[model samples]
Target: VHHGNGTEEILGSDSRFLFISSHTRGQAFYPGTGAESWKNVLNVPLSLGFSADDFLREWSEAGVPGRIAAFQPQLIILSAGFDAHRDDPALGGRLETEDFLRLTEHMVSLAWGIESCHGRLLSVLEGGYDTSVPTPHRQRGGALQRSVEAHLKGLVSSSRLPSNFTSSVLGKRKKPQCGSIASV
Candidate 1:
């Protein structure tokens, strides 16, 4: 996680930050020095091979629900950048659209029951370059509506109710044996 001001704001704290980002490691990319900030800030930059599970593990260890039990955030603004997708010609990452949705889902889950809490969310486009030549996957006029729809549908289908979640900060819940409903 590459913690920064925006991430600090997103997590609603200057401390105990979790900002997951991917950038060229000190290469001659425009507006460089992405990795340099990693060590200096509250960021916990995982090396290569830090997949989504690793992120979840770190997030969990950061005392997620315990932290959220108080100081719940009202909104989540996504600084979305599709350039991380594998089909993007500019970046080297292999992140599929599903990866974005999964990450988005995780963040959304952090804001669960926002309606009851009177909260809202907004998403904005921050970075990405339009390829002059039209790629087969990329529609003309830079329309990724199809991909967005697929990602949104995947998000809905992939989401689970809170009670259905077996994971806890402590550990997984133990399941009862078959035909043992009455044992409770």
Candidate 2:
């Protein structure tokens, strides 16, 4: 989950939209948003050194999936952000690569469960800037590459539903045009 403040601000009062963000809080981070009081938004703000366990617990306890199910959104847009990874200096979130996988899997399952979603999902890359130095820089390039690879793999792997199910659900959509980007 990304710090989707603008999204929340735009769609907060709209019942059809459920905006959720998991990000670091109280440290005067960039953009400085994602407060808990926003309407129709679920903001899980973590302290420095927050781990995956804390994230999982907050996700489960917040009932994010259940909230989405109740909202029954016809489309799901994911702003996948990886700056929360421990190796990322920008936001020191301490999340492992596998945590991103699990997060993606959960979103995939949630989208699948909604009849209106019809496997209609769009993923926009939002964050994850590795600001570490270049000279002995194992953390910047290597970690960014590995994190991106893992995130893509998780998305691809989770999107592979049974062919029959995919055909039946997605047949109603318009044919894909060249150069158009969409996620299943």
Whose lDDT is greatest here?
A: 2
- Taking the tens digit of each residue's C-alpha lDDT, what string does model 2 give over 1-184? 3467787888888876888887777645766677675557888776767787888787788787777788788999988777878777665678887787777766767777788786667778777777444466454454555566666665556244435553575586643332232242
Identify the runs in model 1 with alpha carbons over 4 angstroms from their true place.
1-24, 34-71, 113-119, 130-147, 150-184
Number of clashes found in candidate 1: 0
CA RMSD per model (angstroms): 11.3, 5.2
Please list the residue runs of candidate 2 whose C-alpha ends up more than 4 Å from where it truly belongs after superposition.
131-140, 158-184
Model 1 lDDT on a 0 to 1 scale: 0.45
Clashing pairs in 1: none
Per-residue alpha-carbon lDDT of candidate 1 for residues 49-127, written as tens digits (9 for 90 to 100): 3455555565566454344435444554455655545455554345555676676666556555543322233556554
True-structure lDDT of candidate 2: 0.70
TM-score against native, each model: 0.49, 0.76
